[model samples]
Target: MTDKASNSLLAKLGNQLHKNKLVKAGEILLLFIFTYTFIKLIMPLAGDNPLLIQAVVWTANILMLIYVWIGLKLRGESWKDFGLVFGSISLRSAVKVTLLSLLVFVLAIAGFIIGSVIMANITGIPEGANMSGYDYLKGNIWMLIITLAGVYIVSSFGEEVIYRGFLINRISQIGNDSKKATIIAVILSSIIFGLIHYAWGPMGIVQTGFMGLALGISYIKLKKRLWILVLAHAYMDTILMAQLYMASN
Candidate 1:
């Protein structure tokens, strides 16, 4: 093709990416996975310090946020477009949604436990697959505190923004926003959410997937208000970390 023709083609592709949520979503997902995978690959060289691991993980979250932010700007969107605004929902409504999300969180935990038990009975636990990061934080108050903050800020806020807010909205658009399409989007996003926790083992994957599903449903039902998911996720992580600390002590 001629130089002018190639330039026109490039411009068309850029415009399509800006106009299509699904394309933007694909770019974001690929970018996140590629960056995170590279980080994980180099983690062995970084040693096994929990603090270092935490830092690396937080870096991945920051990368994800940057990618999403750029994508939103390219599309002429704001964070509020992805349910990142507090003023969009009233305090009373936020409280109601949060309470309901907590209920879902509890049920999700129960379901995950039951699923894990059944899977263990059938196949036994996988080797080297038990929860592995907490040992580093055992009896370390400062590390525990850092971890708590990281989980709330990075895991809860960052993951909710990427998985539930971005993925669900983009994937649903891919399906033309039909009911079935939205449901499929929820499931697909949840599966990816679970896969991202592969270090947690099979049981963890299942549990996280279930939790993601619940969060995705809540996101949709609450009109994409993200505060509920963020609160629920932070509460869940807080409980888990508290339990881990208590067990260690």
Candidate 2:
């Protein structure tokens, strides 16, 4: 029985890989697994009330992944097609992409700072509310390092691959015209990205959604060379992690 089960599983894996459906299945499976891990393990370990936030986060994440996959599949792309989406196809391409990505990171940081300042002034929300946790991390370097690494993996690679790599590529196939398709993809993906953060409240939704638009537009503008955006995203999140660490301590 065990041997038969193993064979069956291997067959399924082979089919997914050969058919290039691996990304679709992987995206779904990863989201589910992470959500499960967050609620069942991370929450308890961190002393967070998983019931208050994690359940909602899981639902949003799963739905978004499903939606993106359906859209991509409908557009006739196999998961293998996503391989070329990350960076440039050549060394020159890599250099150009890296520079562009760095520029975007700097701009995003500026935008976040400006937006936070404006919001605080207009709504009387404290500028430092978001910075509180960063202070705590400053006092605990090891924990901060671990947390940064975790964010780098989860936020940069996981989120970027699923959203920019998978979702946008799929949506970019919708319209017959490339330009039209790119526009639609950017708008739709950005909106979905924002909606997923509803658990963080209105500010989170807007901030994340805006960032989505920025990333999507950058990707589209770069002709979908994914490497540039991925690096930019990782760096941006790294900065955020650093800030959070500082605030926490």
Task: Indicate which candidate wins on TM-score.
Answer: 1
- Candidate 2 ranges with C-alpha deviation above 4 Å: 1-80, 83-94, 110-138, 176-178
Please give, for residues 1-249, the per-residue lDDT of candidate 2 as tens digits.
Answer: 699997786566545533555444465456546655655554444444433333344444555556555545554554446544433378886678778889877665654555456556777874332333234456677966775665555566557767777767645543433888778878887777776555456566656777787887777666666666668888977776666656544
List TM-score per model, in order: 0.83, 0.62
Q: Estimate candidate 2's RMSD in Å.
A: 7.0
Query: Any runs in candidate 1 off by more than 4 Å, and if so which?
Result: 1-14, 18-22, 88-94, 124-129
Evaluate residue 141 in candidate 2 and report its C-alpha lDDT on the 0 to 100 scale: 75
